[model samples]
Target: MEPTGKTVVVVGATGPQGRAVTRHLLGSGWEVRALTRDPEGAPAKELASAGARMEDVASLLAAANGAYGMFSVQPTVGSPGTAPDFSAEDEVRWGINVAEAARAAGVEHFVFTSVAGVERHGSEVLPRNLVSKWA
Candidate 1:
């Protein structure tokens, strides 16, 4: 069967999980818009070759135009071992950006891939990113 004319926007399309989602969605006959800062990068280009669109996140609203769904996974700042230069605030801000954009674009399905172990453990010991991924 052909695609049902539905489009899914994968916000971290260059990353592992995002790439997997993009590929699966494409294989399943859904249109995929792969989000990335570098459209020309190897990963984004590879996705593009497989029928996923490589688009910049400068304006998520514009990027998500007419999108039926959105899958958002914040950057490494939200991981267990946060990246050297990024803070928790940065991760949350990015997460919020994606969420607000999805809402603005009227995307019906939204998935925010969050980090682990934050709920079981106390926030004091964890990196801010892990504790407040979308806060």
Candidate 2:
């Protein structure tokens, strides 16, 4: 479908995946709302230069109106041996937070970036990992 005035709020706009998605969406003529922790930072500034509106993720709930989609991504755990640790929990929390916020904001679609491994777990550890995800 033609993007036109459709908006997509991309979480972690300052990160690699978010930046690439923002750039592509902007190029495709969709109104892109890039969520970042710091709007005045260099990465956010770069997105602004490309004609994206930068906003804080925590403050994006009500601002996501008319959004056609939401692109969710979490920060990395940052090294080996971290998967079974707290990093896994953190990722799950971030994902859930974004999903809930998107629902509250009336987003029509939510695109979550999840690990392929999560599908393999299939156990109570999923809940444990989710609890620590945002920690």
- For candidate 2, the 10 contiguous residues with the lowest summed lDDT are 126-135
Residue-level error in angstroms, candidate 1, position 91: 0.9
Q: Which residue segments of model 1 deviate by more than 4 Å?
A: 78-84, 127-131
* Candidate 2 ranges with C-alpha deviation above 4 Å: 1-3, 79-86, 116-135
Q: Cα deviation in Å at residue 124, candidate 1? A: 3.5
**Across residues 33-113, which tens digit of lDDT does each residue of candidate 2 receive?**
889767888889999999998887667775576788999777656522235454665666777788888898889988876
1-135: candidate 1 lDDT, tens digit per residue: 478799999998888888899988999999998997678888888999999977887968887889999998877654433457777677778888999999989999999987665577666776655656424
Clashing pairs in 1: none
Residue 23 of model 2 has an lDDT of 91
Error of 1 at 8 (Å): 0.8
> Model 1 residue 18 lDDT?
88
